[model samples]
Target: MKTKLTRRLLCGLIAAPALLWAGVQAHAADIKERTLRFAFVQPKESHMGYGAQKFADLVAQKSGKKMQVKLYPNGTLGGDLQTVSALQGGTIDLTTMPPGLLVGLKKEFGAFDLPFLFNDFAEADAVLDGPVGKQFMERLPNGLVGLAYWDHGFRNVSNNRRPIAKAEDFEGLKLRALQAPLMIDTFKALGANAVPMAFTELYAALESRAVDGQDNPIVAFATNRFDEVQKHLSTTRHVYNPLMVMASRKAWDSLSADERKVLMDAANEARIEQRRVSREMEAKALAEIRKKGVLVTEVSPQERERMREKVKPVTDKYVKEIGEDVVSSFHAEIDKVRTAR
Candidate 1:
């Protein structure tokens, strides 16, 4: 009887883990297995791609490998406009794009395109992760959901011509601008002949001297090797670009509450990682670009102010376009951040 009892006890112990595993799987039965597509315009090794992969890993882990996220980087799917349309149409599951690219969907997003709006990451983080940011997210289109905001660093000018020391330096220079009304207006207001174009075509355009200059974060300016084609880089810091992580409302609606929680949590976590890496990369790229013999010009405080004043009218036009209440709320949020500091 003792020998028989021992055998039964051992068997029970061996079966215990299997029973627990079965229960856990049963509990997660509502999470259907899926293969989702995530697309972004940056290269696979960029901060954007890193964030996407982080989110994908988190989803897979939390969902017990039920959800597989396939990544399409380097604009493999399409440009930002096309990606946004695909997300809205449910052809794509996720994307991370600059807010300026989203103006067509919600003009209020143009608020982010305002020159010199954010002094640094602290101010930006305070506004974007707080109430004002939530307001923008809530107003996103019916078929799209804003997940989180990641840093795209500050926009600076890179040119094949002379360095921009003041607002006047922008005069008559043809600059390739993002395909957004606010961006075009902002550059035009600063006296540059802003040529709106897709990012994918920017390199060849620069090589062909189709545009005299362009503005982007240092990381992009260097990583895209714009330094090779351009001779000067000015630290204008005109716009603080933020990457908006978005999800398709159709894909979001199809998920169970638990699945949604996993995705949301993962996005927030990945945001932290993405911003940290972006800052590091920006610093490294700046050093690399300088080593390449590019004439790096640092715009003085007075010149920065002059440039800001030049574009003040552009801001005024967009405030009305973006709605008074939204702009007011944004200012109120900024005020809170300043006071807290």
Candidate 2:
């Protein structure tokens, strides 16, 4: 009986090693070796670049180095609009941009572009990580797959003309605006001649005096070296831009389930660190810009409120276009965050 029991134990140990080897092979087979292109408008030192790099590292670790993400920064692949089109056509694999850019594909996305919608990063994060944000992602047009939401930070105005200290200061000033209807309309309602332009061409436009001013996050103003051309920086905080990380549907469909899971996991994990880096950079960038001789101005609460009230008609018009249900759900998410605080 002892001899028989020893033989059975030896057989069980031999089978265990074979079973573990087979499981390892199966896991490896679930991820294929491939390189994906990730393109964005920001330089390698910006938040977008930081997030993209973090995501690439996570994907490589998770996939055991079988998959790679190659980044194209500083609009090397093209402007945001061009990149989105390339993604839908499967010529590009990944990109991140403001949801406002998708307003043409789904008008509901316009709700995100509303001026003065979020009070701070906390309110923005709660709303974005909540259900309404999920609905927006799930309802993306057929050619795109939304992976995660990342920070772009709040936008402020910088110009060569004068500081936008009040709603009246916006009168008759020419400003470069994103090529989104709501964005253009919002600036127009604020009394500026809003020129719709691609981001890639904006620096030259500012330098050539084609537009008097433009609004972007402080990091952009600093990193893009807008201080070299523009002399005034105003803390408008007019709109908070949240970047939507997206993958091409064609490329995504080609990925194995394991590969897809790795990409999504990497994107989300990178989001936390990306936001922290972004918020931290804002103050530092502002100080750097000030050191470069750019005059900084602050918009008072009363003036900001007046600016918001001035754009109410534009907001109301878009709310109807964006669907009342969607807007209400968006507001409810924000309200929940505010009340909880």
Candidate 3:
């Protein structure tokens, strides 16, 4: 579970721009802008792609054809890492992506990857939608603009090898990671030899035995075609990934205030739609993944708890590597959740 980003994050990200552009009056005249491109990875049927399409539709309707958001899905925009860089460089206008990828842009984000941090989706929503969420959002302006967070759901383990009934089953296996440092460390703690690689390259990597296993939400695994390679499905639910939608600050400034409102509202609408759809789709995806000839390994609760206890040090080291306050705030949020009931 990641510590929430507070309003401080919201304010920081919207902090005063250094210098205003001169041609705002001229740009305002052209209210009928042709099209705006929103990028996402995965195929059109995946949550990322579907939500992006919904967002585009929202913006089109709200703006009365003044602007259109064209979606470039299925890596047509590029891989996770490449697309984020493109957004920062203003080569891309918008994108829906996993927040874990943003950790490279800000180490504080690693706090989100701590093992056993969140118990369920409700608790996660409480932190992210509250001050903690706003605080995390604020940190993005230093590198990229922060938008609403979309759920990627609980991450489970899948492999063609033996059943991971306990932490020991993961030992010596090479697991694919989203090229993030914390994930590499997480798999290492689980006794798996972790391989950090691009998301787009993961399928081929697994098929070729370049990596033996990968962890992801069920929807993502099936959507990305990894089900075709590795045949084992382990519902380890090790992580809860949330998608971050952002716009290029440079591209943002080029639009009129009204134009920006249309885009922002569209993004927010997309965020909500994406979360609902993912919440619904994961079960079907899980069922479908099971039908696709992959063995589903379910880790018992006792063993899952044992794995969490064993990974305590991974959490500790990351707390220091990220920031103590970030970790503290997360624990504090959990405390509130525990006290709530």
Candidate 4:
């Protein structure tokens, strides 16, 4: 009886190791070696570029060098709009774009385009990382899968006309606003003649006096060298642009469960590093813009309030369009973050 018991114990131990080995093999089998193409508008030196490279490195490492990401930067694949359309058509694998650009795909995404919606990164992060943002991403059409949100920093207004220290200064200024309705309406309500245009055409427009000014993050102004064409920079901090990293439904559906995990994990890890570098570079960029002899104005809190009041109608109009529950949940999440501090 003792001899029989010993043999059974040995057999059970051996089977346990075999079972574990089989599970590992099954997990590894799900990861197929394939290359994914990632496209973005920024150059290799920008935060977005760094994040893309980091994502590539992590994907390769985690997938045992089996899965790779090929990058196309500097809008090599075309503008933000083109990139999204390509993703839906399976011509592109992945891309990161401002949520405002997603408004055409899903009007609910316009909630993020609302100026002054988030007071700071903490609030923005809380709302975006919470349920509301997740639900919004899940609702995207045409197989677009939102993996994570990265920071584009707070957007400020810059122009060749004059310093925008107050809302009244926006009068008659031809500002190159984003093609999104909320963006166009925001500037319009502030009394500027908002000219909707593509980002690729912006520098030439500003230089040729087609548009008097434009609004973007300081990093963009510095990186794109807008300071050379525009004479004034106002730290309006009007909009907090959240960059959304997305995957094509065609590409994503083809991936195995284990492969999807690797991609999502790398995207989130890159997001942390991207936001850190973006905030750091934004500070340096603003200082450099000042040194370039561009007039920099810090809009006072009172003046900002006035500007906010001016755009209240635009905000109110979009609230119903963006849906009541989602925006309400967003405000609640933001309020939670604010009170947490």
Enumerate clash totals for all models, in the order shown: 0, 0, 13, 0
Task: Report the error of model 2 at residue 34, Å.
Answer: 0.3
Q: Identify the candidate with maximal lDDT.
A: 2
What digit string (tens of lDDT, one per residue) describes model 1 on residues 156-197? Answer: 998988989999999999999999999999999988899999
- Compared with the true structure, all predictions reach lDDT values of 0.88, 0.91, 0.80, 0.88
Candidate 2 weakest ten by summed lDDT = 19-28
Q: Let me know the TM-score candidate 2 reaches against the reference structure.
A: 0.92
Candidate 2 per-residue lDDT over residues 1-341, each given as its tens digit: 99999999999999788766644653666998899999999998988888899989888777767789999999999999899999999999999999889888889989889999998998889878988889989999779999999999999998898988999999999999999999999999999999999999999999999999999999988888889889999999999999999999999999988889989989999999988998899989999999999999999988999999999999999999999999899889889888887
> What lDDT score goes with residue 192 in model 2?
97
lDDT of model 2, residue 322:
92
How much does candidate 1 score in TM-score? 0.90
**What is the Cα-based lDDT of residue 41 in candidate 2?**
95
Model 3: per-residue Cα lDDT over 9-112, one tens digit each = 75666653311221343245445566877888778888877788888877766665557888888888789889888888888888877776878778888877
Model 2 gets an lDDT of 0.91
Model 4 C-alpha lDDT per residue in residues 85-117, reported as the tens digit of each score: 999999999998888888987888899898888
**Relative to the unseen true structure, what is the C-alpha lDDT of residue 102 in candidate 1, on a scale of 0 to 100?**
82
Please give the lDDT score at residue 115 for candidate 1. Answer: 87
